[model samples]
Target: MSRQQLAKLDQLSTGQTLKFNYRQNGVPREGFLVRLKDTWVAYENRCRHIAISLDSDNGEFFTQDGKYLFCQTHGAVYEPDTGLCVHGPCKGANLFSIPLEIGESGVWIDME
Candidate 1:
């Protein structure tokens, strides 16, 4: 596994989600990072239920209320911190989490 630098902590604000690209088996894939309170959380952009991106448009993961990650595709609502699907088609499912590291310089992810 190799770690890839994601973004500077100062670049993200509370409740903000940023999209990132990483390579898997030499194929580029999408992931995302979200700032919740003072912590950073990350996950693959795909939805567990339908294998589709959580966002319908760029950087639109959170619901209108800004409380949960909402998938417009199938109405899946997820807990941003844990990636747990709380409601919608795939209840009891979860988003695929990507391991992340926070350093003094920036955020990093295990891209392997």
Candidate 2:
């Protein structure tokens, strides 16, 4: 596995997201890091129902209520902390989770 910094600790407040990219085993991939409450979570940007991106890089990942991660293209709703698709076509599936490392300096994603 490898570690790569995504953002500084203060760069994101609660309920905010930051988009990032990484290469795993020589394959390029897109991911996003979100700060929820005081915890940070991440997942691959790809939707479970389809290969399309969750937000198309528009950077809007939450529903109007800000209660869950939302896929604008397909109305998929995911639990922010677990990456579980709790609604929509992808129900019962989950966004590909990316492990994270948080520190005083920044946030990092562990890629394999």
Return the top candidate by TM-score: 2
Per-residue error (Å), model 2, residue 70 = 1.0
Give per-residue CA lDDT, model 2, range 1-112, as digits (tens): 7788999888888999988998777799999999989689988899999899999779999989999998989799999999999999989998998888888888887766
State each model's CA lDDT, in order. 0.88, 0.89
TM-scores across all candidates?
Answer: 0.92, 0.93
Q: Give per-residue lDDT, candidate 2, residue 90.
A: 84
User: What local lDDT score does residue 111 receive in model 1, on the 0 to 100 scale?
Assistant: 63
Q: For residue 29, give model 2's deviation from the true position in Å.
A: 0.5
For all candidates, what are the clash counts? 0, 0
Give per-residue CA lDDT, model 1, range 1-112, as digits (tens).
6888888989989999899999777778899999999699998899888888889657799999999998889899999899999999998998988778999989998765
In model 1, pairs of residues that clash are: none
